[model samples]
Target: MTHAATANLPFKVHDIRVEGLQRLPVEKVYAALPIQAGDSIDHDQVADAVKRLFATGNFEDVQLGRDGDDLVVIVSERPTIAKIDISGNKSIDEDNLRKGLKQAGLVEGEVYQRSTLQAIAGELQRQYVSQGRYGADIQTKSVALPRNRVELKIEIYEGKAARIRDINIVGNTLFDDDTLLKDFELKPSHFWSFIKGDDKYSREKLSGDLERLRSYYLDRGYINFSIESTQVSVTPDRKNVFITINVAEGEQYTVNDVKLAGDLVVDENQLRPLLVIKKGQVFSQQLVTYTSDLIKRRLGNEGYTFAEVHGVEQDTGSDNNTVDVTFYVDPGNKVYVRRINFTGNAKTDDEVLRRELRQFEQAPANTSLIDLSRQRLQRLGYFSTVDADTPRVPNSDDLVDVDYKVEEQPSGSIGANVGYSDSSGFIFGANVTQNNWRGTGNRVSFALSRSDVRDSYSFSHYNPYYTLDGVSRGFSLFYSKIDFDQTSVASYAADRLGGSVTFGYPISEYSRLSFGATYEKTDITTGDYVAYDIYQFLDEYGDKFNEYKGNISLQTSTLNRGVLPDRGWSSTLGLEVAVPGSDYGFYKLNWSGQKYFPLTRRWTVRTRGEVGYGDGYGQDKSLPFFENYYSGGIGSVRGYESRSLGPRSPGMIYVDNGTVDPSPDPVGGNLLTEASLELIFPTPFAPDSRSVRTFLFADAGNVFQTEFNDAADNVSWNEMRTSVGVGLTWLTAIGPLSFDLAKPLNDQPGDDTEVFQFSLGQVF
Candidate 1:
């Protein structure tokens, strides 16, 4: 039976006496009371106050009653946290588990809630499951302690990591098992017999492995391959598991004919290069998707609103698994941008956003303009996040409005750091910058640092739009003093002051070309330094060993906005040459290439390679000290110290008495050529975050004297040192942080190869 509150009826209220609160202030509870002493109480108000108190999730129960025209309230308060105990966590240390739980708002000596304890248990299970422990279990219990408090005990049963005992694949007749198995990291056995067997496995890894197999076939023209079923069986001992993957491998197909259908504003020939599938080529679904995206981008650049491309695949029924591919173009209703809306900006002005937008109101919404606008916003650094969406207008199919949503973030930051290492020893540095720079397209930065090896001060500014025509210009000035502590063959101390000014022009929607010139005066102090033979020869030609130098470089980059890409490649080429009118004269050329291929949704393979060469001009035969590439450092060779490789020279060898040795010896000169290769592995942890990624990399490279021009001839396999290690990289809130633990695969006698390297920025 339900009773309704009557306004005319009055209920006797008792003196309001609240109980069972420790941390909560008593005054707060009293102030929330709806009934007072010596007055008639309304049942509805009393009930509402009790409901509010219970809804706080702070009390186990609440009771209210009227006593002699006064109100009384009682609450069984939930206990406050006193202590937390964690047990049975061996793989992840107890401290780490506690910290992870604490991040989720579970901490000792704090208020306790049943829901919070349940949440902690769930998070713990997820952490263990992600590490391949599928059979793990966590249970939480609360025990009352003295003084109205409670202690929590988190019990964990982390079973052994699942192991793969056997793996079988069916319907893979086109390729053998050996070729397909190589793509997976989970294997039945490790390469080395003495090492532990490859037994770590999980259902998640099995799914990823199956996806890899499917994508491999799809990328190679088997567009219809699919995994029908995947099954796993566990052994009675609970130590091993067997997996079976049943796949459906359809016929291999090739493109016999290619055609374009639907409305086209541009000629078909203009769009041909963007197609991935051509006549007489293999028919790959990945290629079709990439072709579609490419056409969309091209049309968007041309101011086509709502442009879309669809791939129409037809079976040719030919003997060689051939098919005809037709790309149906739908340059849907060309709509103009009626308005550009900005949101989530409270401090910044509307003009600030408008200045960065490439697509203006009333103009045709094109892909190029939107992309440029996004880049400009990112460069401003005023917003931590920015996104754009085009919501269609109701009852107007041909019209849409663009919305640029931004999450404003602090535009100014300062950082200070201190650390020590064997290579650089003790170091301290600080940087201050204002990314917004008064809402203009400019940035100002100042940095200062002092280390065992170098001291420097720098100031720089960047203008994203330097000219009314949308050119980018930037300038920077810096002064530095570097001291090489003779850990390597060629070492010297130098003081330098330099600055560079650059101007960039957009060659196309995807390309930019820049030309810049730099001037620097390097005062080299060769007190006890032994000059290389090349330096001596240059000295004979009346070239000062220490002097001023300048150089001009032409740089170009073709970048595709690969926010989402099927397959993409980026390449950079630079050319710089210095003549003898300055202190140094050298001709240098550098080339770098990178390719990213999404083998599947869960895995990607990225490869990068670089090569640089220099030739002496006039009296100079090699690069100057500042321009030369120093190997064997954190940024270069990971396992050794900076400038510690190559040939050795001797001059003024200081004995214990600090006197120079009269006899001198010869050493190697700058390396004429160098190359390196890195294989990157993206981790599942923090996958969506782009600023940082974890990878397992193998690096091999060396620097040598010009006389050893042919690496194969003069370099031994032992000299070709290789370092394999794991690294943690952060696309940091400020910039980047990179740390690596590298070990030389082949260590030579008397080589001082350190096992770790730490750097603050990108390697490239």
Candidate 2:
């Protein structure tokens, strides 16, 4: 600035001019100038403008001057940032560090300020220090570049986190140090600390640990417990931290009585039963809090969304240490839902989602119904995430809007493949399955496959909500030609065509009764050599026949989740009978059940059982060989091939060669029984426990026949095949894939034992 600009005398400015501008607009400088054309100004005003310009941080220096009624503003502009490269950052991700620097105005392509860099470095140091990285260091450099730009580089050294060396608890007589510190997340250094990192010190972690310690006492009836002080110190080497906590243990208090004393919108009798803290019980902060929450939720279910409930303790004057408790209830406004809206459901229809909701618009908000509705939507398995929020309506305290935002996931699979295999040459197949067909919540599936051993075509459609009363309707048609000669079975060929219609009635929320009718036509051809049992059966019942059958089943499930349930039980009991008017008259009864018991957050114990029996009631006098029950393999007894464990075929006899094969072929039996005990554990390295699971299972079962020629074929628990195995089920994009490695614990001489079994493209 010139001496005339700094004169104490006041003067009227005629014009203003800005100098030393690069990359910055002229308007930026004019905006910061207080003295403009035709405005009165003084020395203080000029200094004020100079100070304001510097405050903008765009100018390195600012001065004002006058030249014959022309105010001249001279300023030194800061350099724009050309590049910012941060290195030596290990504990923190580089992207997060860049974001932190950006928030402090130290980003690339913007004007650079040395003070901002210093501020960022200081803040970074403090963050690391708070995390117990006392030796953490930070250094910054600004390299001047051409074209009025600067390059910034930040170097960080995040030292190792300090380890907890000693944790001492003083002034506690009721509880020992180990008992109080057992649940604390922070602990003293010990072996394997490198892996668990529980010994690592952190200010935030310590705060949480202190709160846990306080809760531990408060929950154990120490009503007057108080923490005197807590001290933390670091060693000179800065590699270890010592923590000391002193607490005062007071007399235990017992509850004299629990009484409801606040505004009881609901009946007092109804709320009183909800209290977990009863008369003459030891006082517990945890129980009191739980009872308060329970009461609040009970009120919330009655449309009080903002209800508040708390238990207040009043110490009775006596040495008995008994206290009277009163629960204060504040039932807030009854909020009504003005509208229920949905979003992010691009493929699923509105009605599909609406049908699952128990909450409705234009009704008072019910907390239980709203939560249950959300759970139902999630259990549908069509959405990746289902979230519902009820926000109060603008300008209205009694009205709220319920909004559900869902992210849809592909609930179906479509696959096509063409390949050649030795067992099935020149294989060509196509299959499509959709659970939410056309956004209508219907299930549709179609399959077409061709190979040397088998050629199959099938299609099915099912509507879960076929009726307004939750009745399900489904029908399917299938045609298949199979050659048993190429498989591990007695030489035979069959061509079958069938169609069935099924109807399901919802008996209750967890129970359903279903009825189905089927008609099938079968044509069979036997090879020159076949199992003796099959040969005798084909001779009696003609190779070609038509059959009609009816089926009824009752199923109930109380599973907590639709996928990978960890709790609850499910059972299905069904019977299928061939109509008397048909070519065959037979009946089959089957029951299967499974129950899951959760052992921990990531472990579950499961028990499963299945039993089946079939026999003819009319002229046939025996179950058809094809309709017989065949056990063994993944779904039954592992370590045995599919349909490989059962009554033997006696022996395969070759009529052409006049030679008999000693090895027996598995010819299924009339009765089947299976039981399994499993320990289901979380899938190792799986991103989600719901999509994958692993289990160790012990299986015991075998098929038996009443018309057995030997004791081995007879129904006997001693003859039941047993196996132990580990299995993995992964719900993948293609479908559920399951594989198991099993070892048969008991195997008869004629029993078939295959260790490994697997199935792809199946729902679990």
Candidate 3:
């Protein structure tokens, strides 16, 4: 910018000339200038134009000049960013760092600013410090390239996270230091801290810990407790952190009285019983909050979705040890639902989710009904998250709309694997399963497996909402070959080819009635040294038979959860009868049930029982040997070998010199009974894990042969086998894996006792 160019600034301009512009259009320069062509300008206007051009951050410098009424603008454009590269980043992912940079207006193709780069560097450092990485280092550089572009590079050195060396709580009188520390997630470094990682310090985690500390006192009737100050100091090397929390422990208070105020929709007496806090009980913030929630829930059930219940407390006298609590209820207008909408379900059809909803579109917005709808979708296993919100319509106060958002997850699997099981021997299999086939909420599966004891090929399909009225339909086709000789049972083999079609109708909200019709062909093959029971059945009936069967079952469940239930009961009763056209007419009845009682937030007690009986009917006089129920396995008695318990058939004793070997084949019985009691607890390290659980269980069960054995003999109470065990079940990517360690308490002479049992793809 020369002095002569600014001399004649008030002259009229004919045209504008832009100089020294690169990667920027001449029109943009004209648009940025305050003075344009054919316009007269003054010195101040000229200076203002120069200032405006520089404000765009695109120009390094701007010079204003005039030549015979034509204003000339000379500009030096800033370098455009061409690329951004990052390296040495670990704790914070590279993609996220680049995203943050872009959000801060530092993306490629934009003009680069030196000031912005320094600000971004400071921001990056602050982020690392919040994560306890006080020693993290960050460096940025710009490399000039052809075409007036610059490439930005960011280097990061993520350091070790600071660990807490000590945590001290000062001025604590009501509670000891150890008790207060137990409520904090951050702990001092110890031998096991490396694995638990609780010693690692983070700003967000520390803040949350302080909140928990406050809640601990507030929930225990310390109404006046206050946290005076909290100090956190880092070591000189920034490798360790020390935290000290100071507090004032106030006197505990007791509840003076409880009263209900304001407009109560129902009778005050009706809501009084819903309160958990009594007049004589100690003041508990947690109880007050819980009671308020309960009141809201109770009102919600009555269609008072917008009701508000707030607890107001008043202290009396100088002692200040008694607080009067009053719950004020404001029952607003009862709101009704206007419409239901679904979002974020691109892969699933709308009708599939609509059928699961219990709340109607135009009905009142029942909170419980909406919650049940979400639970139903979660139980389908097709989504990872299901959320529902009822927002009021823009201009309507009495009508609200229900909106459901779902995040879909993988609901199908296709794979092949090779494994081994003690009961089935070496196994190889391939399977294709889809629980939500094509997002229609249909389940379809096909599998083929080969093992030493069993070989099977099966296909099944089920539709849970066949008619949208809570009816279900399913069909299955299977062919299986079982070798009993490998199972420590009778030396016999059976090949069964069968197919069945089932239909189910919902009897109630928690119960269903189902019926199935099946057709099968069974070919039983006997080998040498077969059990006497099997030989007798083969002698009476042919080795091959064709049968037609019908089954009816009723099942009901009220468990709070589908995977790991905390409280509820479930039961099933099934009856299978061979129709009149079967070669061997028979009938089987089975009853099973389970009940869970939550003893505490982290502990539960469960009881389970099952009973089964089978007998021949019509022309047949007794149950077929192969159809008998055998007890003792992972599903029955834990401390016994698979299907290796029950009545035993005679076998020859070999005598070689002075040694005698006894071989007894386990012959399954027609009647079976089993019961179990378990104390379930959350895993120690993962107390909130829904996929893992541990339990101590006691099991008692046995198989009885009634026809050949007298009722007073084999059916006695002493004949039942018993075991006590500790078990664990973990749900994994492949399937659920279960392990049990048991000790047989009442083992008979010939019973096979196995102290350790494990199985895959099974749960208890």
Q: Pick the candidate with the highest lDDT.
A: 2
lDDT of 3 by residue, 299-327 (tens): 87767788899987778664748989999
* Candidate 1 deviant stretches above 4 angstroms: 1-333, 342-358, 367-387, 405-429, 432-445, 449-455, 481-491, 526-550, 558-567, 621-627, 650-669, 672-676, 707-718
lDDT of each: 0.67, 0.84, 0.84
Score every model by TM-score. 0.55, 0.92, 0.80
Q: Per-residue CA lDDT of candidate 1, range 1-764, in tens? A: 11223334366554677766767787767666555666665666766777777667667777875444445576777788888888888988988887887887678766688888898888878877666677899989999888889889999999978677778888888888889988886687455522543557755666788878877897788878889998777676656677788888887788899888888877888998888778888877788889988998888777676788999788877677788888899887777787789899876667767876778887877777876787666545566567888887788876778888987655555678899866566889999776567666476888999888678999998786687666888888989876666223233445768887878777764456777777766665443344443234434443233333333334333323222111356666776666456656676677666666666664555565656666567755445434554456565666765555554433344322344444443233345333444444555666665444566666666654453222212434456556777776654555556788887777666455888777653433
Better of 1 and 2 by lDDT: 2
Q: After superposition, how far is residue 63 of candidate 1 from its true place, in Å?
A: 31
If ranked by TM-score, best first, what sequence of candidates would result? 2, 3, 1
**Cα TM-score of candidate 1:** 0.55
Worst 10 residues of 1 by lDDT: 557-566
Q: Which pairs, if any, clash in model 1?
A: 13-69, 13-70, 14-69, 14-70, 14-71, 15-70, 300-367, 616-621, 691-731, 692-731
Q: Candidate 1 at 12: error in angstroms?
A: 38
> Candidate 2 lDDT, tens digit per residue, 33-87?
7777999887678778877888898988787777777788888889999999888
